[model samples]
Target: ITACYCFGALLLVVASICDLVSSIQLGQDSGAVLSRPANSSRIFYGVMFDAGSTGTRIHVYTFIQKDPEELPVLDNEMFHSIKPGLSAYADMPEMGGYTVRQLLKVAKKTVPRLEWKRTPLVLKATAGLRLLPSEKSQALLEQVQDVFDESPFFVPDDSVSIMNGTNEGILAWVTVNFLTGHLYAETRETVGILDLGGGSTQITFLPKSKKTIGSSPDDYIARIDMFNSTYELYTHRTCIKYLLCHVIHRPPYIIVLLYTPGLEWRVFKSSCLPKKFREEWSFGGLTYIVSGKPDGESYVGYKLCYQEVLKVVKDIVHQPYELKDTSVFYAFSYYFDRAVDAGLIDRTQGGMLEVRDFKKRAKEVCNKMSKYRPINPFLCMDMTYITCLLKDGFGFKENTVLQLTKKVNNVETSWALGATFNHFQNLKIHR
Candidate 1:
């Protein structure tokens, strides 16, 4: 009996060894499959997430092998963002935790079951959390970490990290260059990138050139400088004082605007507007007009047009709307009027309206404004206008300049956040 038992144990050991070898071979074969020559079916799955002030989005990517030597193609991609807006945290602190939970839930729902365990997840937050006070922000981050639990689950951890505004601009520049196939094999030049986001805008100037090294083909050499300005116009004290006055005085114009059609109460809740506007409108029955409960479609175009008109009026009045300076407003309004004159937006019907000649009008406005002195000279010409000037005024090809501009505008959260995850993985492997 003892001899028989020993033989059985030896057989079991042999079976285990065979299983281990099979597993290793399987892993090797999978790697080989990924390395195969160009084929449509050679894609491997990956995932990325962008947690921003407006919402969190999870994007799944499938990479297809392009060739035996070249990097795989980023094939199919899909994404979903937290509904309504991620910026809810700015007004309703209590909703922050709930919003994050909902965001995670949506991610789990969207990812395929097979990929649920293997796909890499990247979580990146911008704008909203960055604006929070340090203590409150840390607490929010802690809550996120607790929820994610730092597990190597398909979802990334909740620890909040964001690229500086300058880096955001640089990433935009790189993305545009890659997309347009304008990434030169050899050239040296400085490119300025500006990005306008829902909550903020970033400006970055990058000096770059391409150098050809033997056998390596060509490579880019780049240096970047970044600058960021908050959208909030008033100082904390001034804002508080404004809020207090608004609460006490209860401006008549606010009531009139709130109760009117084409000017929904919900406009007050817009993140683009200041907090005082939201609070005042919220209390003044503006919610009912904005909600459009009775007629869902009635407020659609009207609401949008009204918002644009209101924005123009605010510009005309020189009222401080965050990130929207008087100059920007004037440029936008002038563009809208030009659109109206050009039959883009009907001038006869005077409700909320859309402008057609927006780009042209803005350019004209900027050109005219440039003649006058200004506080920040750069404000006279935004990234778009500057690109136009480069193309038209400096004899740069429109297509080439546009290629660069698009690169500066295409900012994807996944690519930026994924680099961080890759670094962490390398550290873990070495350890």
Candidate 2:
């Protein structure tokens, strides 16, 4: 049985690789023009599904390879998204499969009818599914597989699976770099990536200092070969949702244990929340009654909020060496959304801001919680938490400039494209 699973996995990888290479080869005869010969007008498509914590997005990419010697350039991408995520269907696996089936209709309409069998379809679930119980996750995946099996498009055995947190960061890094043209640049100039998702956060970058790699935990440092360049990448999962917000309910004694066990969970408190506010929050199938201290003392400003969020991050997050150095970082997901909500950046066209900018904004937001309450109840807590995550968690200096963006060159800034690139590179089809 184990051997069967391994063999199935191997076949799945080979299928994905072949699907990507065939697409590239299909467009090799043409370099330009719409009035080209039938052979020269060959166009191929690839579909990638990003099942995130917040929503499920489909990226229908069209690629044309003018020269076989050069990498295929992305011609266009048709993107669409639906909310509530596949993880939200943990109990109703059939409904989750139905969601995927609904998204497949978009791909069917986007790709040529004759190309349905040739076009490859894949879905990569993120931390949302990872946070679910193993059984529930498996059931959801199985349902997705069933839906794929029923679809007209080519579905590889590994078409649907939960992506690793580390690879999540790496793929996002590749997508941003590729879009920014850094991946194919002559020099090794690359920007770092900080992705803050609801269920997890990822920090990935190329380390310039030897101390950064040497001091990091063995697993935190990963080496990946891509774009014909081998890169030693540093990834820190500490900022992940696993530890970031687990502070609210932890018992004082097990505070050392951190993320207090599920069985021991009780009413959680933190200054990050409004002093008089208390609510029930749900995540990963678990609900917690969380609130600020019930004591008579009123929580006034970011001072207390900062300290509360700090305990969840300080000392636990690794400080990347040479962080004071000016290196461009593209932060997105929750980071982008929060910045937009906080009025730090434009929603349509993102802007640049510094690490200290986030800190300062967080202080202002938290201090004026009452004023912003109508906009978002958790504005203060979320801002303060992100502030601490960047400054204390990442050890970034106040002046560290980060480009907070949602897209680059009109392509949504996420890991879907990078994962697609990985599929394309893994293929080794000889003429």
Candidate 3:
């Protein structure tokens, strides 16, 4: 009868988790089967849907509570994803809901029919829907609610909603910490997270110094109560895709583009891109025409690209007190992608690197565009942009080493797992 639900920025199926926690804590010696387990093992499933900007994903998590009074362990996860996220159907609310319906097929097949009525279903959306018009966003959410109501799985209150930016950072921090064993160990030591997603990027960690908390912008800090302790984490979100979108009214993608003085061209050029590269890119439902100047005999490589990227990051990103010294950071998403594409790390095993490692590779890639061109067209731009982002954007020193990973212990290093953990704590499960 354990149940939970999720659909949003990350996939989370926490229904069974909440119930399992509740049951374990409420367990007492009694003749009733509800008060004590009739058997030694109890198993349940949770269905989570991640309605992201680029895609919609599902995570069907099964957990086992070995003892009646102990915490449950995640047994397995069945993950799947579909393209063209709900945001793509901004004008077609019903179709967005239909996508949810289609993903539910996996849930139906995964969870046993005997437990279907008791299994909980939930969905949470992230930056994608958050960027949409209010009317359009609500229409899509309402349609999904209708689909949930029609499904056989247990539907909980607030089953569909948009996740705020702050929670996104906090949960991701929790996920990495949990996977790294920092959450359960005796030590408070935890690694910071640098996640660069398509729409936005986040920086989060448990601040060691009180000054770190005091100096940060009020909104950048979040208070989290977990494992019987409270932590004030330094968390913030910045629009890494600032130059990609042109909409002036959007909240997160806000940017002030600087142009060359008295340049007669209408296009905005970046040294990060290939000098000869000219193409149209689309983001947030808007298309932008961009290209690099090929004719000019200029060194528009890493050094110049670094300066240009600095314009977007400098004087903006808040430097954490701990970042100045030494700290471990697990950079993922675009960070991992670019590193693999740049030959800095193995795509499957992943590898560690210093912030300057990225810089060195960026310089090499940007200078020898022709050699790496066939591997990936954006190799130069991506490598250079990431280098600038880590060094200039976050103000990390060249020698600052980051443990870049896409997964830890087989589970993905994503915000979803941390968010799932929070779901139970938020409910205040007690015996």
What Cα-based lDDT does every candidate model obtain? 0.33, 0.71, 0.71
Candidate 1: regions farther than 4 A off: 1-42, 66-70, 83-87, 90-97, 105-112, 150-159, 182-192, 198-200, 205-359, 363-431
Q: Name the lDDT of candidate 1.
A: 0.33
True lDDT of residue 379, candidate 3: 72
lDDT of 1 at 247: 27
Model 2 Cα RMSD, 1 decimal: 6.8
- Give candidate 3's error at residue 386 in angstroms: 1.6
Model 2, residue 363: C-alpha shift (Å): 1.9
Candidate 2: list runs displaced more than 4 Å: 1-40, 239-265, 282-287, 293-298, 428-431
Order the numbered candidates by TM-score, best leading. Answer: 3, 2, 1
Task: Report the C-alpha lDDT of model 3 over 1-431, residue by residue, as the tens digit.
Answer: 22232221111222333432331122222211223234536566677788888789887766555554565555556778898899889999999999989999999988888777656687889878988899999999999999999999877776799988778878888878866777665677888999887656789988888888888889988888765557788999876444443343222222233244465433456665567777654555665545565766375676776677677767767777767775889999888988888899999889989998988888898887777878975676677667777776777888888998877766667777676666644542222
Comparison by TM-score, 1 against 3, better one: 3
Supply candidate 2's per-residue lDDT for 232.
92
What TM-score should be assigned to candidate 2? 0.83
> Which 10-residue window of candidate 1 scores lowest in summed lDDT?
20-29
